[model samples]
Structure formats: structure tokens, C-alpha cells
Target: MRTMMTRRQLLQSIGSGFGMMSFAGLEAASDPLAARQPHFPARAKHVIYLFLNGGPSQVDTFDPKPALTRFHGTSAPSGNLKTERKTGALLKSPFAFRRHGQSGLEFSEIFPKLGACADDLCVIRSMYTERPNHEPSLFMFNCGHVLPGHPSMGSWLTYGLGTFNRNLPGYVVLCPGVPVIGPQLWTSAYLPAIHQGTYLPNNESEPEKLIQHLRNRNLSAEEQRRQLDLLASLNRLHLEREGGDAQLEGRIQSMEVAYRMQSEAMDALDVSREPAAVRARYGDGDFARGCLIARRLVERGVRMVQVYYGNGQPWDNHDDIQIHRRLAATSDAPMAALLQDLKASGLLKETIVLIGGEFGRTPSVEVSGLVRVQNGRDHNNHGFSILMAGGGVKGGLAYGSTDEFGFKAVEKRTHPHDVHATILHLMGMDHTKLTYRHAGRDFRLTDVAGTVVRDIIA
Candidate 1:
């Protein structure tokens, strides 16, 4: 019979060889949020994803399909695309489109503010996903899989690049209220909990309310530091007695970070300190305030910051597609302000900005059995549109295209995995090389499939 060697016993046998070196490596790995080097020189040091929670109608937004008007209320072709609900005849966009910027990128009337800044935007009109439903598509966008229990793109970035600022979380998610799938969308499944996005409800602009329990009312800064040091020492002693545990080490590191955050987080999250003109530029509202804070966070060295549009699929206009104009109104000013501010601050050169949702709405009008919807569209995973700017992406260029009817991606089609790969590439990470071994297989953000869309790179 062969006897199995315990980890301690194996370490004892290898003590004279590489035991000390191995222990040193383990200690270094303890601080999961500690900054690490990228695979190569990175074009984007930070990322800010403006996630429009519900699928936005591409035909009504970035992609202008005049063909819809030509075929409006007419049914001739029997091969129309199927959707989540039974759709009526083609619906023409109520809003008008006008060319903007030197690129001649067309923008709908609703996004006049964003349209003015069109030169900096790279609109991809041929984007598609695997699912049409919110839950699966949301998971697909954030975690790279239709199913849950996978690390999100933010988590992967933090895991790969670690954190630039220890005082604040490397990955931050700002939403006024929970989206449909909730925290699972930002979860760091299979990755260290520390890499999970730090969710902040922007409903209240108060810094204290945004970051609950940020300060200890009873303990002064010095006293809190002393307490943290003692607690860390005790934890270290316990770790030495019980071999190394990743979870325990993570908890210890989190405690240390929490202690440090008490001093800096308050100042970082407080947007009221901004100049009056700057505050006025971003406007007043949870989404707008979240955008301002996102800029502030990226400026302070946070790796990835996601500002969701609003709570619970706010853009899912089932009854009236005209509601899109209202939603766009709320977003245009803040988004434009963010881009302009980043450029003025010179942060735009090093930060990547992504805007879009999980999927897009169908071009044809949708009619549900449960209710009557006159102007709204159904979910369309066949095609969608998203915009990217800054980083290393070419500005003022629209890549790929959808068909004339705007029902599907017909030319130079791109998938979410491809986008993920492109994003990691911009961040100087080879999606294939950046992998975590689990379940006896190497898992990655791109999964088994992903091809970097290199043409968009500046």
C-alpha cells in the first residue's frame, strides 16, 4: 500500500530545495488586489463601461435603417426574423437621423448631445449575442457565458492586472438600483471575492450613504490602524499554524484594505467637492452623478468602473418605443460631459469607454398576447449596436454593419466574445494567455472562442 504525503510533509521534504521560495511566493499572492504587470505594454490603463441595462433599439439609436420606412406597415417577404414575441409589420423610427462630425456618423435626434461629440465615438452596428432574454444575455455580456458562476470581465481585469489603487476597490459598479439579474451580473464567481465589483447605489448623492460604514465613529484613524495591525498579526499567526488558505488570506487582505479605505474612500466618492461648473455640466440625476463619479474613480486609478443606466431594465420599452427618447435625454448630457472631461484631463488617451447594452431591440413592431403594444420592439439577439472610444480604438469610425432592414448583423459581424477579446487586447492582455485553471481546465474570459477584432485598434 502506498501512503499519501500531506502538504506539510511534502514541504518538509522540499525544505532545502524550494520551500522558502515557495512560501515567499504564497505571501506575495495573499494581497489579491495588489497591482500586477500586464502581459505587455497596455493601450488602456482603465475602462469605463456605460451599460444600458435593457436592450436599446439599434434602429432608433446608432443604426439608422431608412429601409424600415420604405417597408413600413407592409408584409411581403415571408422570411422576417423571429423574436421573443410575435411582431407586427415593420416599424419606422419616429426620430429623425442626421450626420454628425467629420466622420459622417449618423445620430438620432434623441442623442443630440452625444451626437455633437460623434468624432470620438467608434460605433459598431454589427454586434450580436447568443441570447435575447435579459437574464441569460446579461450573464453573457458580463460573464462571457449564458449561465452563471463565472467571473465577470471586470473581475477578470482585476485578476489579471490587479488594482492600481488599494484604498478603493479595483472594480466598481455604480447603479441607482439593482438591475434584473442583480449582483450576479457583477459577481466574481470562481475568482477571489476581492476581485468582485464593489456595488454602489447612486440613488443618494451623499458619500456616506453611497459607501456605508466607511468610517468608524468610535475609533480615530490612529486607533483603527492599531486595531487592524493587531488583528492582522493574529491572522498571520493563525495562517502559520494552519497551512495557507486562499479564503482566509483574502479575508485578511480585505480587512487591511477596508481599514485603509476609511481614510480615502470618503473623499473619493464625494462629488459635491467638484467645481460648480463641473457639477452643472454632468447635470443632476442618479445616472448623471454616477457618470461623474465614474470619471473621478478612473482618474484615481481604478481599473474598471461600470455605470449602469438605471434600475431594472429601464430601456426595455415594450409599450411605447418613444420612451427611448426620454431615456436618451437622461443619458446624453452626462455621457457627453464624461467624454469631454476625460479629454480635457488627458485621461481619454489612457482610458477605454464602452457604451451599449446586452442586446438590442427588433426592427419590427412587437405585439404581445398579454397586452397591446403599438410602437415597441422585441428583443433582437441577431443584431445590435455599441460604441467604443478612447483607449487604442480609432475614433470617428463606424465598424461593421447590419442589413438594410436592421434585423441582423450582415457584414463583418462581431460577437460579445470578440468584443471581450478586443477589450483585453486593448488592455495588453492576450485573452488566450490570461487563463485561470479550474475544474481541470483552463478557463478564460473569452472561453474557448474569441478573436480580437484588430481592425478597430488605432
Candidate 2:
């Protein structure tokens, strides 16, 4: 039988050639999720973002203002700062604060379990954002831009470093239901769509229900493989005709990932396989389940896992600030368990765990017509707090602070850009150098502003 030359082979034999150049990079382009080397010596290999959606009150959690407590029900000195709604006298945190562990890091009464892990947490009390509203701030926190059409930090990481396991997605998002901004929060935007986060609505306990259509009931693995091969050939031919299409290539890559996932994805997502004792430690609730799943994903070589606390900004406690205590109760145990579990498994040193919300709440009572209760706090974009643990960060350190009333970042003031830059730096990428050409210019997670806050790094 005579050997038939395919279009790829025909071009390869013609001079130094188009096929040689294009197909040489073909394998690399086809496997976009293949693991790659970091820009330098990376301190961390994985990141787990514990997104506490909406604004959690800093004064009620990590940042305690003695002045606010002292002058409770009195006008704040910094009350002149503009807020989204009208506010009244200073609302002192109802929850008391106390020092924990050798770090002496203070925590609110609601977070006893998390406070136990204080020695491992690096609290940033001076975190600020560009907006007081949820939508823009969420965009800023996740995508580095105050707009929706930008790749999230997780998307950027997966795009930059890829993943170790080709059987699973490089980036994963866990939420019981739709988050505030929905899928846009994790979109790849100008980046290849394959780099976008694989979202899992983790409402079900069973792995099959957790990830719908995870297994095909109609076809065997071998049969499915043959079908995919044929489909791939057709896609490649179409791709050649179109010259090149990033979106089309992305879909091809994503199809391969979905196929490979049939082998390992279910096992990775099933929390029931974990020991009964382990389940007890993580506790019961959507947030708890998400924390456990985050650990599992990172353990299995996923580049990044973003676990949102709940759906529709559950932490947006505009009516009653006491709701924070209830929310913290549900999240505290799981947060601590994740830290302890990572440390026990020796993954803590190479995995970064970031915990915080979009912004923080005002120290004064929210007395606006929009608010239902008289005791709630307004949104405060000027100041907030976030916690970082493991991944070569200096634990037990509070790097910055808000003023006496906890209204604004006063010292060592840090922005969302700074946090993004610092996270990239820890993962061995220079913030300024991590760029992707989109439209007519280059875009990055930190945009034009961001300095690696190296002091927090070990």
C-alpha cells in the first residue's frame, strides 16, 4: 500500500517549512495545561483562595479599634469620609477580642478555631480597595481590574504555570451556588478559554451530582476515545482552514481535559472517601465542604482553587452585624482545619492559603434608609483585613494597621494590587513581567500599579 501524505506531512517536507514551524509548537499549544517551570525559584506551587464574599467587618473580626469601643454610640472623628450610605455614631464590635497563640495576634470571639491557628496566619490589617460596592470590588479583588472583562488571578496562574495533572483542570472554583458576579469572576477573558476556572457547584455530597455529566452512561472509555480522535482530526482541519483560532484551540484543549477527567476527577472530589474524623474536623456546611475540596484539589496538583464562602454575598451583613458571628461560626472550624491539615501533610510550605473578603465594613452604625437594621455597618473601601498563611509567608505577623476607629488604612497601607503582586511574587513571577498581549496593549493581573509587599514573605 502506498503511504498517503497528510497536509501536515506535505508542508513539513517543503523547505524549512510552515508545518515544521507550526507543528513544532503544536504539542505545546495543544496541551496548554501541561506543567511548566516558574519564572524563578517558586516559594509556592499552589494557591487556595478562601473568598469570604461581600465585606466582612474588620473591627468585628481581626482589626479591633479600642477608640471605637471607648466612644461607642458617639460620633467618629473620621466620620467625614464618604460611604455608600448614611451612618451614625461609631458601632463598637460586639464581639470581644483576645490574643491567641505565641503570635499574640488578636482575633474576635467568633473565630476561636481560626485564632488557634494564629501562629500560622499573617494578618494584613491595612488592606484597602478602590470601591465600596460589591461588584467593582469583587472584580478588582479577583481580576485586578475594576471591570468584569479581565482574567482572574487564578486564570492568570493557570495560564502562566499550567498544572501538574493533565487529568484535572488547572484552576477550580467551588461554590454551593452562583457567586455575586457569577462566572465572570473567574473568566479568562482575553486569555485562552481553557485557562478559565472550572466551576463546580458543590451542593451535592456525591461526586457524580457534584459535577454534573462527569461520566457518560452511554459510552465506554475505549469507544469514547475513538470518537474523540475523529472529532479532533476534524477540528484540526477546520483550524488549518481558519489559519488559527485561539478560541477553537481552547475548546479542543478543554475537550481533551474533559476526556481525561473521567479517570480521576470523581475520586478527587469525593469527600466521603476522607476519614470520618477528618470530616468531623471540617464540620458541616457548604463552606466547610468547599474548604475540604480545596485541600483535595491543591493536593492533586491543581494550580489554584478559589472557594467562595456562599452564594450571593452571604457575608453582606447590612441588616444585622450579629450575622457575622453566625457566619464565622460556620467557617472558623473549616478554615483552621485546612491550615492544620496542610501543615500535617507538609503541603503548607508549598501552598498559599489566602482568606478575606472584597472589602470591609464601616466602624459606625449604618443609619441609611436602604439598611433595615439600626445596628449594621456600612461598606468601607478605605480599609479592610485579610489573612495569609503558609507558602513561605512569615506567620504570626500583623503587617499593617487601620486608624483607631478602623475606618481607613493608616500605615503600611496596601491595596488589592499589592496583594495580587505579592501573591505572584511568592509564586516566583514578577508582577510587571507577567503580561499577556490583548487588543493593542499588554494586560496583567496588577495592571500598571502593584508592588510586591516583600516584608510579608519569608
RMSD of each: 4.3, 4.8
lDDT for 76 in candidate 2 is 77
Give, for candidate 1, the lowest lDDT window spanning 10 residues: 1-10
Q: What lDDT tens digits, residue by residue, belong to model 2 across residues 1-458?
A: 11123334443455444433433245454456778777899999999999999889999999988888789988976554787888889888899999999989999999999999999999999999888899999999999999889999998998788888888999999999988889999999988888999999877778898888979899999888778777766776785566566677778777878888999999999999999999999999899999999999889999999999999999988889999999998999999999999999999999999999999999989888887778888889999899999998999999999988999999999999999999998998888888888787888999999988999998
TM-scores, one per candidate: 0.92, 0.94
Q: Which ranges in model 1 have alpha carbons more than 4 Å from their true place? A: 1-30, 76-78, 236-246
The candidate that achieves the highest TM-score relative to the unseen native structure: 2
Model 1 lDDT per residue over 1-458, tens place? 11123333444565555333433243354456678788889999899999999999999999999988999987526546877887878889999999999999999999998998899999999998887799999998899999989999999999888878878889999999999989998987877667788899999889999988888999998888768766765665565579755566667667776777886788888999899999888888999999999999998889999999999999988778999999998999999999999989999988999999989998888878744657898899999999999999888888999988888999999999999999999998999988887677888989999899998989
lDDT of 2 at 411: 98
